[model samples]
Target chain A: MAVTDEAIEKIKGMIVSGALRPGDRLPKESELASELGLSRNSLREAVRALSLIRILDVRQGDGTYVTSLDPQLLLEAMSFVVDFHRDDTVLEFLAVRRILEPAATAMAASRISEQQIDALSAQLDKLGDSPSVEELVACDLDFHRGIVQSSGNSVLCSLLDGLSGPTTRARIWRGLTQEDAVSRTLHEHRAILAALRDRDGEAARSWATVHIASVEQWLRSTL
Target chain B: MAVTDEAIEKIKGMIVSGALRPGDRLPKESELASELGLSRNSLREAVRALSLIRILDVRQGDGTYVTSLDPQLLLEAMSFVVDFHRDDTVLEFLAVRRILEPAATAMAASRISEQQIDALSAQLDKLGDSPSVEELVACDLDFHRGIVQSSGNSVLCSLLDGLSGPTTRARIWRGLTQEDAVSRTLHEHRAILAALRDRDGEAARSWATVHIASVEQWLRSTL
Candidate 1:
C-alpha cells in the first residue's frame, strides 16, 4: 500500500510540475514504471487508483491520459464520500453549506441574468403553494443549484453540488415532519428569488443564510 | 466502465441506506458479488476503487470492511485531486479559501484555547525575524491550518487543508518574486493571532479575510 501510494504521488507530482499535462498521454507502461523507479505492478495499481477518481482516463484500446483536471471533474469524487457521512455529520455538512451557499448566492446576484431569474421563478411556480415532499425537495435543490451555478465558479459549484446529496435528504425529512414546512420553504424561496431579482447581493446572502439556518435549526432540535 | 460504476453505486447505496455500516465487514467476495447481481470481477474493481478513496479498508489477509467514514479519511482524496490543479485554477481554489477560511478562523477565535494560542504563537516565533522561503511557506501553512483546525469542524478542516496545497505553491512563487513577502506574511499572522488571543471572532474574521485577500490581489496582478 505504501509503494502504491508513493507511485500515486509520483504521478501526481508529474502533473503538478507540468511534466504530465492535462490530456497528456502517459508513457508506455513498462517504460514509465522504470522511469518512476517502480515495478510494473505498482504502476498498474497506481493508474487504476487514479482512474477511479476520474483523474486519469483509461481508454479501452488507446492509452491512458491525464484528465482535463477540471474542478468539476475532480470534485465529483466528493459526492461519493459525502454519501458515507453519518447522520450526525449531516449537521456539520449543513454548517458548511450555510457558509458557502449564501456566499455563492451573493456572487450569483451580481451576475445572474434576467433569463436565469425567470427560470428560477418558473421553477418556484412549478412547485405552486403546496407540493409533495419529493417535489419540494427537487424544486428546492433546483432553486439553490440554479443560483450557485450562476455564480460561475465551478469549484464552488462542485463543492456545493457534492454537499447537496445528503443535504437534499435532510430537506426532504424536514419537509415531511415539520409543520408549515411547505409554506415556509416556498416563502423562503420566494424571498431569495426576490433578492436575486433585485440584484441585491446582501439580501441574497442574508436570505440564503436564513434559509439554510432554519433547516439547521430544525436538524438540531430533531437530533 | 458502466458495470464497474454500477457496482460502485450499489455498494455506496448500501452504505448510505444503513444496510452496510462503518467498520462492518463485507460479505465474502462471491456472495457479495452475487447479492449485488455483479460479476466478481466488477465487484473487485469497485472495491479497489473505494479503497483508493479510503471509503473501504482492505486487509491483506482478512476481507474488506467499510471504513470509519470519518470526514478526514474521506476528504484526504481531495488533496490528491487538488494536486492536479493548474495555475489558473489556483485562483478559483483561493476564492473558495477566502470564504471558508475566514469563517473558520472566526469560529476558532471564539473557541480556541490559550494552549492552542500559545502553540500557534510558538509556531510563528519559530520562524524568527528571517526565514527561507521554504520555511516561511511551511509556517504559513501551519499558521492557517492551526486556526482552521481549532475551528473543530473536521469537514471544514479537510477542505481548507486540501486547498492549502496549491495555495502553498502560489505563496512560494510570491515570496520568491515579490518584496517584503516574509515580513508581510508574519505581520498578518501576528494580527490574526492577536485577534484570536482577544477572542474576537469578528476581528479574527476580518483580519483573516484581509490577509488572504492580499494574496489574492497579488495573484490577480501576477496572473
Candidate 2:
C-alpha cells in the first residue's frame, strides 16, 4: 500500500471506530506525520483527500477538525463530479430524479409538518409573480429540497441533492426559458404541497411523478 | 479560491469543454503544474481529489490519465461514503433502490435483448439451489445490476447502483440469517424474471415493488 493511502485509511479508521468524533481536531502536521509513520508530504496527500470529501475540514491558519459527518455534507463532494457531466447526462439524471423525488414525497406525506407544507407553499407563492431562468432554477431546487428534507430520510435527501447539482439545474433553466416555466413550476409545486397538506402519500407520489415527467418530457423534445 | 481548487476546476473545465477527452492522458505533473500556474505540490492536491472520485486515474510509475468518465465509473465513488452508514441509513438507501430498480426494470422491458435476459436467467440459475449468504448477496447485486444496465440509461444505472452499494448489502445479509430469507429471495428473483420474459412492464414493476418491499418490511420491523 502507498504510504499516503495507508495514512488515509488509518485516519478513516480512527473516525469510523469513534476515536475521532465529528468536530475533533487533529494533531499538528509534524506530530500526525510521525504518529502515522509517514513523511509530512505523504500525510498532506492523505489530508488533502479527506478534506475534499468533507471528512476533514481545513481552514488556512486554523487547525483541521473532523466535519459533522452528516450525509448531506459528505455527499456534497459529488456536486463537483455532477458539474462535469454534459448535455444528455442532465436529462438522464432528471429521469432518475423522477423516480426518487416522487418516492421521497410519498414518504414525506405521512410526516410532513404543517409548517413545512406552509413553507413550501410560500416559496411557491414567492415564485409565482415573476421568475427569470435563474430564479426558476433556484425556486425549483428549494421546492424539491423542502419536501425531501421533510421525508425524514437524511441519506435519501442528501443523495438526491448531490445528484441534481447546480450545473444541471442551469441547463434545465436554460431549456425552460421557452415558456412560462415559472408558472408551470409553481403549479407543480402547489400540487405537491396540496398532496402533502392532505397527507396523501399516493397523491403526493403521483403529483411529483407527473411534475418531473413533464420536465423530462420537455427536456427530451428539446434535445 | 485556493490554488488547488482552482487547479481542480481548470482541469474539469478542460474536460467539460472537450479540451480533454475521456481516456486522454493528462500532461505530466510538472507540465500540468506549470500550465495551471501552480506548484507541483498544489497540483497534486487537485489530482488526488479528482482521483478519489474516479475522474482521474493515476498510475504509480506512469503519468496520470483521464478516466473513461463513464457515469457508472464516477458514481462508484459514492460507495466509499456509503461504507460509513451504520443505522437506518441502510433502509433509506434501499427505499431509493426500491424506486429506481423497478423503474429501470420497466424501462428494460422495451429495450432488453434476448441475450441479456439469458444472462440474467443464468445468473439466477446459479443461485437456484440455496447458495450461501455471500453467494446470495452477490447474486442479488447482479440481478438488479443486470436490469438497470438494460434500461439504457447509464446515469440512472450508475446512480441506483452507487446508492445501493455493497456495504449496505453486507449489513442486510448479516441480519438475514433466517431460513425464510432463503426461499423468499429466490422466489422474488424468479417472479421478476418471469415478468421480464413476459414483456410486461407494469407486471415487472409491480413484482419488483413487492419483492423489494418485502425485504424493506423485514428491515423496518427489525429497526
Candidate 3:
C-alpha cells in the first residue's frame, strides 16, 4: 500500500474499532504520527483525504475530530461521486431511482404526518403553474426530498439524495424541450401528494414510479 | 472554501466539464498548479483526496490520471463510507437494501439466462447441507450479488454492494444464533432461484422481499 493509504487505513482502523469515537479529537500530530508509525506528512495527507469524504473534520486552529458518521453525512460524499458519472450511465442511475423513490414514497404514505403532507402541498402551491425550468428543477428536488425524508430511514433518504445528481440535468433538459413537461410534472406531484394524503401506499408508490419512469422514458428516446 | 477544498473543486470541475477526460493524465504538477493558481501543496492534497475516492489515480512513478469514473468504481467509495455506520443505523441500511434487492431480483428474472441460473444453483449445492458461519456469510453475499448483477444496472449493483456492509455482521449473528436461520436462508434462496427459472418477476420479487424481511425481523427482535 502507498504510505498515505497506510496512514488512512490505520486511522480508519481506529475509528471502526472504536478507538476513536465520533467527535473525538485526535492526539497531537506528532503523537499520533509516532503512535501510528507514520510520518507527519503522510498523516496530514490521510486526514485531508478522510475529511474530503466527511469522515473527519479539521477545524481551523483546533484539533481534528471524527464526524457523527451519520449515513446522511457519509453518503453526501456519494453525490460528489455521482456528479462524475458518464452520460451513458444516467439511465442506470435513473432506473435505480425508479426502484427506490417509489418505495420511499410508499413508506412515507404510512408514516408521513398530515402536517408534513400539507407542508408538501403548500410547497407545490407556492410554485404555482407554468414555473421556469430552473424553478421546476429546484421544486422537483425539494418535493421528492421532503417525501423521502418521511420514509424515516436516513440511509434511504441519503441514497436517494445521492442518486439524484445525474438525473438533475435530465430533468432540466426534459422541462426545457418537452413543452408539456412542466404541467405534467405538477400534475404528477399533486397525484403523489393526494395518494400520500389518502395514506394509499400502493397508489403513492405507483405514482412515484410513473413519475420517474416518464423522465426515464423521455431521456431514453432523446438519448 | 478551504484552500484544499477549492483545489479539489477546481479539479472536479475540470472532470465534470469534459476538460479532464477519463484516463487523461493530469498536467505536470508545477505547471498545472500554476495554471490553476494553486500552491503545489494544496494541489497535491486535493489530488490525494480525490484519489482516495477513486476519482483520480496516482501512479508512484507515472503521472496521475483520471479514473474510468464508472459507476461501479465511483460507488465503491461508498462501501468505505458505509463501513462507518453506527449500530443503531444498521436497520435503516437493511431497509434500503430490502427496497433495492427485490427490485433487482425482479429485473433479473426477465434478463437472467439459463446458464446463470445453473451457476447460482451450483453455488448453492456446493455449500452442502452444513457449513461454517463464515461460509454461509460469504455465500449469502455472492448469492444476492449474483442476482443483482443480473439486474443489469451497475449503479443498482454498486449501491446494493455498498449498503451490504452494515448487514454483514447482522447476517453472521443470525447464522450463528438462530438454529433454523441457515436452513431457512437456503430454502429462500432456492425459492428465489426457482422464481427466476420460471421467469416470474413478481414471485422473484416477493421471495427476495421475504428473504430480506426475515433477516430484518430477526435483527429487529434481537436489537
Query: lDDT per model, in order?
Result: 0.84, 0.84, 0.88
TM-score of each model's B chain?
Answer: 0.89, 0.93, 0.95
Instruction: Sort by TM-score, best first.
Output: 3, 2, 1
| Residue A70 in candidate 2, Cα distance off native in Å | 1.4
lDDT of 1 by residue, A173-195 (tens): 66455557667867999999999
Which run of 10 residues does model 2 chain A get worst, by summed lDDT?
A: A175-184
Candidate 2 lDDT tens digits, B1-223? 9999899889989998999988899999999999999999989988987887888999989889889888888888777777665564678778777878889999998889888888888888776565777898888888898898999999888877877788778778888988888788888888888888889999999988998898899999998
Q: Please report the candidate that would top lDDT against the real structure.
A: 3
Superposed by TM-score, candidate 1 places the C-alpha of residue B33 at a distance from the truth, in angstroms, of 5.6
Model 2 is docked with a DockQ of: 0.63
For model 3, residues A1-223, the per-residue Cα lDDT tens digits are 8877888998998998899999999998888888878888778888999999999999978888999998899998888898888778989988999999999999999999999989989999999656676777788888999999999999899889988964456453553555587678789999999999999999999999999999889888877
The alpha-carbon lDDT assigned to residue B27 of candidate 3 equals 92
> Where does candidate 2 stray beyond 4 Å?
B128-130
Specify the highest-TM-score model's number. Answer: 3
TM-score of every model versus the real structure? 0.89, 0.92, 0.95
Higher-DockQ candidate of 1 and 2: 2
